[model samples]
Target: MNAAVLALLLCLASAATYATAAVAQERLARREATAEGGNRSLLRTGAWWASAGLNAAAALLHAAALRYGPLTLVQPLGALTLVAAVPMGARAAGRRVASGEWRGTLLTLAGLGLLLLPASGPAPEETLSFSQVLVVAAASALAIGVLASRRAARSGLRHAAASGLASAVASALTQTVAVSAGRGGELLSARVIGVALLVLTFAMGGLLLSQTAYQGGLGAPLAVVNIVNPLAAAAIGIALLGERLQGGPAGVALAAAGALAAARGVLLLTRTAAQGAAPLPQARARDRSDLVGVKPAPAPESATVS
Candidate 1:
């Protein structure tokens, strides 16, 4: 098969790998929550390490895929990891996912599929020249990530938002590195032994932040983050590197469809969350009455989203 075809397959495999890792992460969170009042450690429980491992595997797969595919396909496909994690989390918690979640997941995948359809041709193998673009992109991505991570504790969804932004910035830098690096360079960096280290460090930081965000708000935030990351990277590609998208309006239309699908998925997740939020005030009011022993309440009901 051609390079584009190989890239497309790699992209899909990367998505699947990411999704599996996310399922593991969601399960770990549910387990952590269950052990909340008990003695536990992230290390002993193997949660952090497992997450790191799966994520590393995914990153390796993604980087290889990137060598074969376009950024637009690879990054968007990775977002599915978040979408897949929600139901997995619910399952781990022994709760059934709401119908809305199922709908949302389907919508997200459908949209992503639109964006991943192979670009026709053997794929560009342009020889690249080392430039300052990668370094500048790195600095900018790090700055933005630090800014966004400050919001993680506010709400679960905020976590997703932060992760998405961080991932986008990191991807932007990564793309710059991949596209700008000279194929002719004998060394990883032109001058230093640690240049690859910086690249690896930024990439890992992005992954860790994104993982945290996914744990807090697995769906909506990731959806938004996933969508926004590529858009930003693509924008960078267009403006800085003179990258041109193949196919005129048709390709764009397909991508728009994917964006819309992902958007619908976000709407479903947020609406379910909103619906769940509605009962909280009423519950609080009842709790106040119960404090005075006024209302003889039934035992605390085990409520789960269905």
Candidate 2:
């Protein structure tokens, strides 16, 4: 089998695992209040640990995918996590999959397909220079800082986008580390250490933001993450890594359109999930004494009493 095919499969599997983890983690976030207890209780839960394990596995697969595929190709495939999550989430919530959900899922998949079809070729494996590394670190810190600042006031969409971008930066750093490793560079080198620190900061920040983003339900936040992570990584790949698509302007246009379509699907799915998660209106309890202003039966008097 070709390495590229294997890489694509690995990405798909990673997406599946990630989808499961997202569902599990979202449930944990809903069950345990992070602000009140700082996720201590949540950390102890089996579900939390299970999700963590799945995510770890997915990360390994994602790294492997990056090793064999271009960033633009592999990253966008992560959106499948959102597609997989909808049905899984529906099952967990004891709801049937709606038509709109299916439509959104199909659109997302089709867009992903279009995006993949025109990829010119695998990107050349390139290592970041010292200057590039510094730039990435500085940019990552600033972006994450800006995103973190809004966490207290922002809605779920913003939180998700922030976390997704953080994760993307981390992904880009990871790719650089991989390139270094592939070129026989020492892992303990200064360059590796600097990048590793940036990766750790962004990754942890993204994780926490994602947990808080659950207030709006899994679909919205997960969709944002799916959309943002790839786009961010692809941008970094093009700008920093000198990656390019083969088909020139036309290819770029198609890719952009596909991305927009996928985004639309994600938005639709988010809205659908939000609607599903909404609680049914409850019946108000009536006070026992009022009885809707109806008078109670008069007390019985002695028999034959006037």
Candidate 3:
């Protein structure tokens, strides 16, 4: 097969794998949330570890896709994870996919496609200095701290956004290291080693944060992560890597519109998820009352007579 076809297949496979892993992680999260004492020990759970393994496999598939295809093509296809996830999640929960979720997923994908399709080709070969890497790391940490603060109402969305930022920074750093190594720079130098360590730290941080994010629900949080990941990475490319969007002002306008659309989609998704979740306590309470054989008191005789 041609490179493009191979890349497309690989990307699709990667999306499916990611969706499956997300379902597994969300299941684990839900169990932890409802469990007594809330052990929250994901590391000890075989399913969590299995999900992590799936994520690693998906990453390998995605890497192979990138090797065969350009970023503009591969990156957008990555959004298909949300598409695959919605139905998969619903099926796993023993429910039909909600219309709102379908709408939200499509809107998110459309917006993302608009946002990414206008991108110019590969970025210039670039490397961040050690100091620059430190600066980037600090900024990412600050952003994550702000989003992941306890005051956040939507814990899943907040954590997903933070995870996206961390993953983006990690991607930027990985690109830097790769570019430097490709150009025959010192791969074993102290600076390189430091950046490599930062990459690992951010990557793992993103993973753990995502695991937490899945506790709320699958569709919205996953969409947020996928949306934020590419946008943040693009921002880094523009600000630090000398990258620019094509078509100048027109391109900028298009990107802005796309951003707005993507935001709307995320809002719709979160609202729907929130609405769905709002009655859980009452439902569980009713279930508990039934279990205990509780019954409502009858009306007074006067009231019944009236």
Best-fitting candidate, scored by TM-score: 2
- Give the poorly placed runs of model 1, Cα more than 4 Å off: 29-45, 80-87, 116-131, 134-139, 146-153, 169-187, 191-195, 215-217, 274-306
Tell me the whole-model lDDT of each prediction, alpha carbons only: 0.57, 0.73, 0.76
Per-residue lDDT for 188-271 in model 1, tens only? Answer: 565323334545665665555555555443556556666666666555545554555567788888877777887888788777
Instruction: Single out the weakest 10-residue window by summed lDDT for candidate 2.
Output: 280-289
Candidate 2 lDDT for residue 168: 88
Number of clashing residue pairs, candidate 1: 1
What is candidate 1's CA lDDT for residue 164? Answer: 57
Over the stretch 1-306, how does candidate 2's per-residue lDDT look in tens digits? 776898889999999998998887776666554234657766756766787788778877887888778787888888888778878865655456677788778777677666765563563488677688778768866776676575554677777888888888878887777767777756779988888777778777777778777666777678778778877887888888877765888888888888888788777877786666432111111111121334444435642321
When summed lDDT is taken over every stretch of 10 residues in candidate 3, the lowest stretch is: 278-287
Q: Rank the candidates by TM-score, best first.
A: 2, 3, 1
Q: Candidate 1: global Cα-lDDT? A: 0.57
**lDDT pick, better of 1 and 3:** 3
RMSD of each: 7.7, 10.4, 7.6
Error of 2 at 81 (Å): 1.3
Better of 1 and 2 by lDDT: 2
TM-score of each: 0.70, 0.82, 0.81
